[model samples]
Structure formats: structure tokens, C-alpha cells
Target: MTYRTSLTALALTLAGLVAHPSPAVALSSVQWKSCPAYSDEVIRSLRVTEEQVPAFRTLMKRLECGTVSVPLNHRDPGGRKIDIAVTRLAATDGSRRLGAIAVLPGGPGNSGYLDPILRSALRNKEMAGLNERYDIIGFDPRGVGYSTKAACPLSPMGPQEPGTMTKETARKIYDSQVATNQKCGRSDPAFLGQLTTANVAKDLDLVRAALGERTLNLLGFSWGTYLGMVYRSEFPEHTGRAFLDSVAPPWTRLDRHTKDAAAAAERNFGRMATWLARRDELYGLGATARQVREEVARLVGAYDKSPKTFAGLQRPIDGSAVADLAKLNSTEWVRAGKALAELRTTTGTTAPPTVKELLGAPMMGTPVPGAPETLNMTMNLAVACNEDAGRTGFDTAWRAHQRLVTRHPATGRGWGLGVRCAGWPLPVQETTLRRGGGSLVLAGHLHEFMSVYDWTLQTRRAVGGTVYTIADDVHVSATRVPECAADVVRYFDTGRIGSGCAGVALPS
Candidate 1:
């Protein structure tokens, strides 16, 4: 049977099972225990240091940690089981407590288990209200964080090197990516095919059952929005109030979604240029936004011809690097402009201090010594590849890249969507998500590059909900905008969200 047909059959089977209650069978309750100990190396991989362990432990004192056993393949509940790591902060006011609220962080790979500590350290006060009446739950999805991890070899070509628009360069990158994925498959042959969003949603349902909650509230960001949608679709009867922040469109194809992301980045770049040009006296890049954009393009061309080397960075900063940096949101435009200006002033010997510091910092591809390969990146590949049923071969990927470069030259190459899952050794299981009859509050920022505002509208329409748009450049609305955060908190408390795009706070 086709993937969609199987999904339909599964949905019907699940509905029938639910309709005909089976009193004989019950899901096993979670065996709560003290959180498992992690080595210093593992702790560091989570970006928590040895010095912070005492505080983290102290924080954990007030919460509970455990693992939920879930089937490796949800299609067969009697199949091999895997452990999903979970953390819970019980509601302070149990008298008024609502059900559990599962926090799903973005990156398909990001650890939700660490979100509580990270939020505490960042002083995120917006969710303080919800914390009073809801048990805030976080978990590492299967094959991520403290969960059973899936390891893979790094690409042999090293971190994606800046590419020239040549067939040879594209071919080399594609082969390297494929080899890297193949290596991951070899490393964890049994689990790679199971690390999909649909399976993750199934694992989530198991978590809810173990918590003894019949329903759950969902708070999802970026890729998490997609997960939330899937959860609502499969288990709509078990869904409570949902707050989807920085929504991602329901696109099954990775290439198309990435192309849309590149276009959005280009639009965001335009906004940044306009903002910089208005402050021309301070930045001195250009008097008009158009001139500023043209100047940026010119600089990219000049740097492409001859890359600049800094004192601290191992690799030289090239045109591609500049273009990539330019795609940053409006908040970072000033820094980007400063870096550009410093590059323009290079006399082939002296490097500006700011430029040196910026270039010296570890970028996306920078490999840290002794650091474990992140579960986020690994699972991202697994999930994206598992869901994508469209063309992922070298030729198709090359054409996508070419189209991106031609249409959105400023940010296309930097998007890095090409050849991501070209050699993923997994069968596609496309999810046929149906809109659940649940009230949802979707939120987005006007300037979000990755999850653009259009995605919010599309998702809102798909799920039938009110959208709370923030007139700001922040990526995730709830974290940055107070009003947006208030809406989320209010929605959780009362099943309604106040509408208005008033408060626009710029990121610090």
C-alpha cells in the first residue's frame, strides 16, 4: 500500500479502537525516578558547564525526571521499545491545575528537556502565569538529547565549504552529504528509519498517558509547530489548548519549504537594508535602501573575487560568507554593516578588531573538540528525510540550488537546503494530517526569516484558529514580544486570545 493509504487505514483503525473502548487493556504507567547521570562530556554537549551542575541539580530538586517506554514503531505497539527522556515541573497551584502542557522546542533536534533550565537562566517571565496552573512538561524526542541517541559520522568534506556555482562543486557536496547520511545509517541501522515526526507524535501520546492525563496543552515553536499539528491530527480528542509559535507551513517537501525560506530571507534582508539606510548618518552605508542593497551586492562580488583572511579565523571570509551574514534579521543588521565596513577598509594587512572577533567566533559548521555530535542535527536529517517523498537526488537538488541562486542570490547558497537528505536510507512515510476540531492560537513575527509571517496565515487557515501577529522582527513572537507572550499565557489560562499588533519590541 502507498504511504497515504496506510495512514488513512491507520487513522480509521485508531478511530474504531477509540469508539469501541477496550477496558481490558491499559497503557503502562511511567516509572518515575531520579534523572539519569550524564558524563561531563554529555553535559557540555547540552551547553551546560560543570560549574552549573550544582544549580541545575538544585533546580531539578523541585521537579521530577523519568523515562517513558514507547514502541520503536507505533504501527506495532508490541514492537521493540525505546526510552524517551522526560522532565516535569508540577503546577504550583494544584487546586486550579489544568492538564500537562508539553513544550516542544524547534530544530526537530533541540532538546525540550533542557528548555526549563534554559528559560530560567534567560529570565523568561512571560510563562510565569501558566506555570501557576499547568504542569510544564518537556522531553527529548527519540534519538535526541538524553533519549536513545543516533550518532553519525561528520561529512568528509568537513563543514560545508563555501561553494562555487559549478556542477563539479555541487556534485562533490552532494556526495559528501550522502556519505555522511549513509554513515549515520550504518551507525544506527535499527533506529534511523523510526526517527520520524509521526513516530515522535506517537511517543508524545505515550508521554501523556504515562502522566495520567487524558488531554494535553501544546506549546510548539518553529519545527515544533509541525509536530504539534501532527499530534493534534492524530489525537485530536486528546488535544487541549494549543499555542503554535513561529509556525511552519504544511509542506512535505523539504526543497520547496527551503526555497520559500530563502525568498523570505531575501525579503527580511530588504527590511534590514531599509532600516540601515534610514540611519545612514550612523551607518554610512548608503542614503537609500536601494543604494545600500546595491552596495552589499557589490561587496559580495568583490569579496568573491578575492577572499579576506583574518588573524583568528582558520578560513578566509569570502563573498558567500558576507551574503550569508547579510541575511541576518534587522536586529543584527548594525553588526553586519559594521563587519562589512571593516572588510571594506582592509589594506591586505591590518584587520579591524571587531571583524577579527566576529570571524573568530565559531560558526554553524565549526566543529568543537570532544563535543558529542548533536542529536538535533542527526534527528533533523532523520525526520526531514523520512517525511520527504519528493525528488532528493543529485540532479534534482542541483536544479533546486540553481533556481535558488538565480531567484534569491543574496541568501540562496547560504540556506543550505540542497543535498540534505539525498542518501537517507529510509522509507518515506508521508503524514496525511487532517485539521483537528481544536481551538488553536497561532503566532508569528513580521520579520522572522526562517518561519515567515505567511506561514502563520497558512497554518491558521489550515487549523482554523486566530493568529496573533507581532509587528516586530523577532523570529519567535512569544519569547520576544511581551504582548504576544501575554496572548499565549492568557489563552492557556482562558480559552481566548486578545487581538492587536501593538507592542513591537526590538531584540537586544
Candidate 2:
């Protein structure tokens, strides 16, 4: 599985940013030390907070945190420096050790510094073998964590914004995002643009050197899966066994990705409708799936024309609020369905506390400057805006949103009404993948809304891999559930995926 990035071509295309020739000696070896205890404020404030911190602390005491010095610009190795923060959990049984595997965090910006310590805790049994047999390493990619932060105000993720996706609101959102893009880019586009996946892959290889390891095995979830593929393409020789959970279709277009996600959301909602219809006696949603769908749509449309205030909500429950709930995962369908049913027929001035609690932020305040979560918000947009090459034109985005919401009302409004990365100063950098690798195993969920099943096939078409399907409708469940994790453990242990691995941890 030699995947050398069409080196000849990438070398030229990348010019200075990637595909280096006669490259300077890669940086290796970090100065390791006991990790300092991160404050609970910092931990809890993180966008992807690991809540089991109190439990992970038992193993956290054994963790080592350090920094490996790399070039701010890979092409200019001797210029200013960047420190990639890392955490390592050495093998408990060195005599039986295989090798090291770097655990890449998912968010383009989420901190991975704590991943090795937290993910390998005794409670996270899926990673037990990795903890015992090899050095499990985690790192904060450049522009994240202690590495460096791209300081830019970020638009809130999910349905954090209020209001319906009318042409007026859509156009306004698009304009504002475009403005934000122009302003954020001017804060050192040349330097910030270097924070691409290709560069991160280079950082990973350097991290490999730091460990004195010849080959690195891998395990990545969600967006982490995408990063692993890029690493494989860049340095396949150094990549050993890789288990990519929730494979992101290498189709790198943000518009396409989000649009597809909306479709998945709609499909999952339909499944929920069927489930709710069967329990009509309890939910009183409807006797049939079609009627349930219609009732849900009618409720959402009413909110579109006239939003209403529940007893405890800081803001009114608008169409977007109801529409946003349309994309619940299979696990949340029951709770969300019950919430929706109450809203449709409620005679009280109060709404369901659970739903209101779930809609935690009706009036989002300004992001706290210097908060731990700030790093994520800034970097996610900076990295996405830096890479996405799509339509920034307001007219196109408006027309697309109108068409989509009309067709898939439950999911369409959530797709796009804003021009993402509009007027970003950085030139778009592109990547090409060639299919030949087979050391990779991809995990796919049959009806999961996020990273739908088709994307798994799409990714496999680009690079060869064995895939096992989860007979559930949840995202990234393979490595988390005992039955599904069997395949992953087997792949890492024997360099082969196990067959007939079954079941996921479905909630009662």
C-alpha cells in the first residue's frame, strides 16, 4: 500500500506549502514531562469537552505532555518556529510492545493534548490493547491548543442562530459571513493558510520521528478519519495499520458535504417518524408515518410565520428551533419525538423542560475571549475557510437553500443560507487521492445521519480499504461499542479485520 501522493505532481502543485523535495531534516524528539492538571473551567469550556475527566485523572497522572519544534512554514525550516503540543502514554508492557500510534483529534481545531490520557482510561476499554501494547500518542495540530491559536471570531456551530431561512434572512447571513471572511483573512492569510491537512500530515510524520518509531498505527474518529487519510496519502510508508471510524467522503467540498448531511438528517427524521407512528397511543403524534411527518411540518411552518415564547426560553421558539430538532439521531428520536408531540398539542404556557434544556442556547452571548472553547471556534472556521473552494456568491447560496428547504424541509433550512469562506484571502489548496492502499479498515453505520453510508463507498473508491457496516443509525459507533469494536481491535492486533463482528450499544 504505497500511496506517495502522485509525488511528482503534488511537489509542483504545492510549491512551498507541501510535497517537499530535498526537504530539510524532519524534526524529531520532544522533551517530555509530567502533564500539568488542566483546570476544570478549561476542560468544561472546551467545545468537545471530555466530561469523564475525573475518571480519566487516574491514568492522567501517568501522562506526559511536551512540545516538538517544527517550522512555522515547512518550506522555511530555519525561520520562526511552531511548537506542536503532544501527550504520550507509553506501553505498559514494553517487552511485548508493537509500536506507537498517534491518536489524531477530530475537529480541525479541537485539542488532542488530552486525548491519549483520556481515551486510554480504563473506562475506555476499546483502547485498552493500544494502551498495553504500544505508545499511544496525541497532539495538538498547529493553530490549536498549546501549539498556536488562530484568533478569529467564529460563527456558532449547529442551529445556534435564530430565525427561519427566508430569502431575507438567508441573504443577510450570507453577507455577514462574507464580511467576516474578508476581515479574518487579513490577519495574516499567508501564515494562517499554511494550517492545512497536508501540513498537519507533515507534522504527524515529524511526530513519528520524535517517537523514534519506524511506522505509526492509527485510530481516528469523525473528522479525525479525514486527517488519517491525508496522512496515509502523504507518507504511506510510515503508516502501519489505520482504523478510520466514520469515514468522511474525500469529496472535500464544504457545500456538498453539508448538503449531503442535511439529506441524511431528513432520512433519519423519516425513520423517527415511522418509529413514533408505531407508538401513536403514547406520543399521539399520528397513526401513520405520513401523518406524523405532516404534523411535524405543520408545527414547524406555524413557527415560521409566528414564533412563540415558552415559559423559560430566553427567546421565542421559531421555525429554526423546530426544524433543527428534525435531525435527531436514532438514540435521541424518542426524546425528541416526545418533545415535538408536546409542542404541537400543549395547552400550557410552559414547554417541555427537557426540550428547552436541550435547546440550551436560545440567546447566545458573545464568545468569551481567551476561553478554552474559543480556540476551537476560531480554528474550525479558519481551517475550513482556508480549504473550502465553493460558491461564495449570495445568489447561488440563496437559490440552493430555497430549493433544498422546499424539497427536504426537515433538513434543508439547516444546510446553507450563508456563503461559507466567502472572500477568504487564502488561495484554495486542493488534494488528489489515488486508490491502492489496503492496510486501512473503514467503519460505516447503515443509517447514520452524519457521514452517511454512501460516503464510505465513495472514500473506498478513492483508496482501497475493507469496510464493516454497523446495523445502527448512530455516528462513529464502531470503536465505542463492544461488539463493533471487535473488528477494530482485531485489525490493530493481527493487521487484519475480523469478520462477523456484530451489534452496537443501542440505548434502552
Candidate 3:
């Protein structure tokens, strides 16, 4: 999900995690060993050429890979236990060493064991400099890959395209998901119930104890940002400076968060419309923001009534597809406008082009540098359902979905109906983040989608911290940016935030 890399190796202490092991399970220290095959995608993202692969491989060969045993429930450390997979890259210069920095990734299920690649993948020497001063740590949380996996049948239904989910369709989907929740959640209630964010934070403290370190700094993103906050809250005395990029809201009401995200998406759509309006002479969509929005809505409605066939595509060009594009990442704003313009022509009077000719090429991808990350949808459901306390039933859910769809046309139709937790097996452990740790640096983007920008400000307000506003929409991208990476390294080396620096750039 994130990345890191590096040099001299350290011997595994192989000693007891605590002065003595728990009666139920003996905790082992992280044992450094031979690393697994590096992710092809991660290597590709780093632009690690054939010539560079050999050296890169040699560099990563020094990577420490193993696991640490932690209790399944921190409340009962003497109860059943689970293994937490881990990876570490020792600092190149131990003499000037600061301490360890854990790379906490986004997906509650995102595998982090191979993330040490960002040190070499990123464009600046900042990571290299940061590496010299620290030991980078990566771990797959319990119930994720390499760690004890949380298994269950995935929900039969998922969020659908905008304009396609009618009240009837929503009800059917909700019932199916509720059924999945009961069945899957019942599979392993004891272990699955322990997979909350709070438990992960407890596991991090265990990792710190195993490392024999008094404090551990955090380098987290998206979901990881929330994880860092929780860790800091749980173990403030052990938590050091944290760099949380693309921060999540400190609050835990999943429904409210979902509503805010849908609103943010519509707001971003407006921003894209403004951009297209300025270039109306070229696209012929509209001369102003409001006109462009109306034209897009009309185009979507027409396609909804009757979709047009297109070769080489999996599905026809329909209202659902139209809405998705209209609110895609900013990088795709140009193509989205042209595609809608082409649809507008045909629906209104006569015509459009073979998709590519109208919409142009697909947008660039933002892949993580690790083995292809998978969403243990099983883990996703368990975590989401357990984390969300609102537990919205179908009645309230339908009403909320209708309100969102009617109020926010651009993204509301596609937003989740928010009823999955209604029949969840585990009791909700709503966590209210309590600030206690060292200095924290929060980074946010202006045109974000999944983890909206507002959450950043909300998080800062929740827990006092310095904030950095990124102009681009890419999630968790600060370390990938040259200036932002420097700022991040500076913060870790000496707690200081960046000025109004540039973020990921949009296409020219």
C-alpha cells in the first residue's frame, strides 16, 4: 500500500516479547530472513529497470522478514494469540539513527510486508536521507495477508453504478448483504471479533515492545491515518512523530462519513465542470459551470432510458457509466467532458463516436509498490461492519440513499446505501480518537474522492496537528511528491511542517 527500502541487517533478538511470555502464548521477536519474490507491479512503479533489478534485489535482500505473536484480544493478553507478519529495513547510518518508522497502509486489508520499496521508488533523495536516519518497518495487521487471515464468504452484492439502483434494487442488495454478514461473521466469531482498529493499535504496541524500543514513529495513509491516530491514542508514551497522509475522519460513524464523501464528490464534479467551461470553445459542452452540469445530467438521463452499444467494451454506454466518468479523478476530467459532449450530441439530436475517439484514452493508474494489494473483502466487511456503530436498518437506509441521490446528482447515485452493518454479528466498538502522543502532521488534497479533504480538517480539529493542503486529488500521495517527501522527512528528522507546497500535478 505504501513503500520503503535499504542496508545493513540486524540480528533477531528471539527473546521473549515481555520479560516473560504469556501463559496462553509465547511471543517471539521479529526474525530477519530471506525476502519473498518482489511484486512485479511494485518494481514496475519504481521504474526498476532490468539493469537496476539486480542491485535493487540485492538491496532488498537485506530486508528483514518475519512475524511476531500477539494476543488476539488485548483485553485478555493471556487468551488465544495470532501472528503479525512484519518486514524491516535497518537504517544505513545507525550512528545518526533516530528510531523506527512503521509504514501503516490504507486498506484494513492492504498487505504491507513489501512496502520498503518507496525509499528507492520515489523521485527524491529525501527517502534515501530519511533511510539513513531510521529503520523502516512494515507489517500486515492480524486477519490480513501473511498474518492470520480472516476468512469468510464475500457479500453477494456490492455498491452499484449511479442511476441503476432503484428502491427495489436497493432492498434486494441490502437483504443479500445482510445474509452474507450473518453467515460470514458467524464463521469465526471469536477471531473475527478481535479484528477491530483498536486491536491493531494494540498489536503495534506489541511490535514496539518486541523491537525493544521505547517509542515508534508512524508513517500512515488513508485508513492507516486513522490507525496511527488510534495507536497514538492507545500508546501515546510509545508513539513518536506521525505523518498521516490522506487522513480519515477521527469520528467513527460510517454513515455520516459516507454522506460527506458523496457530497465531496459532487463538489469535485463542479470543479471539473469549471475547468471544462473555461475550454468550451474546444469541447463545445458549455460556456459556464452550471450549463456544463445541466448538459451532463441530460446526457446521463438519456443514456439511462436507452443505452447505446459500443464495440470492445464490456458494457454499453449508459447513464451509470456517464455518471461515473463525470465524477472521475481530475486527471480524467478532460476525457469525461468530451465523452459526455459526444453523448449529448447523439441523444439530443443525432450522435457520438466509438468510445476512444470521443473519450480518449483511459486515465493514468496509481498502483501501490507491493505485491498486488487485495481487499480481503472478507476482512473489509468484518472491519467495516464492526467499526460502524450507526447500524442503519433497511428503512432508514432507503430513506438516506434517496436523499443522497436526489441532493447530490454527480456522486450520490453511486454512493453506498449504508446498511451492511445492520445485521453485523460483532458489537460496534465506536472509537473516539483521544489525542495524547507526540506531534502529528496531517496531509490533505483539495479534490479528493474516497477520503475527502474535509476529513483532514475534521481530523486536525479532532486532534490538534499541523495541516498541509495538497492541490491534487490523488489519495496518499505526499511521499511520492518531491517537495512533500522532503517535508515529510524534515518532520520526522525535526518536527516541522511544510509551507503551501505544490501537490501531485494535474494533466496539462
TM-scores for every predicted model: 0.87, 0.89, 0.86
Which structure among the candidates has the greatest lDDT?
Answer: 3
Q: How accurate is candidate 1 locally (lDDT)?
A: 0.72
Question: Per-residue lDDT for 1-508 in model 2, tens only?
Answer: 0123354643343355533432675556797766766565554554334766565556677788888888767777777677888888888889988888788777778777777765544435776766778788888888887786667644443333456666676666766776677566655554576877778778888888887888888888777888888888877888888888778888667777767877787887888888888889988889999988888888778777777777877756777777777777777776787778767776676867666766656444554445433236567776777668674587777776777788886655545564777776556776666553338888777778678878988888888887877777777777667766656666777887664244554444
How much does candidate 3 score in TM-score? 0.86
lDDT tens string, model 3, 73-156? Answer: 665677677888888888888999999899897777777766665542233567666777888888888888788876686544
In candidate 2, what residue range of length 10 has the lowest lDDT sum? 1-10
Error of 3 at 377 (Å): 1.8
110-140 per-residue lDDT for model 1 (tens digits):
7788665544322246766667888888888
Worst 10 residues of 3 by lDDT: 1-10
In candidate 3, how many clashes are counted? 7
lDDT score for residue 112 of model 1:
85
Backbone clash numbers for all candidates listed: 1, 1, 7
**Candidate 2 displacement at residue 477 in angstroms:** 1.9
Name the runs in model 2 displaced over 4 angstroms: 1-22, 39-55, 153-163, 361-375, 435-438, 499-508
**lDDT score, residue 499, model 2?**
42
Q: Order of all candidates by lDDT, from best down to worst?
A: 3, 1, 2
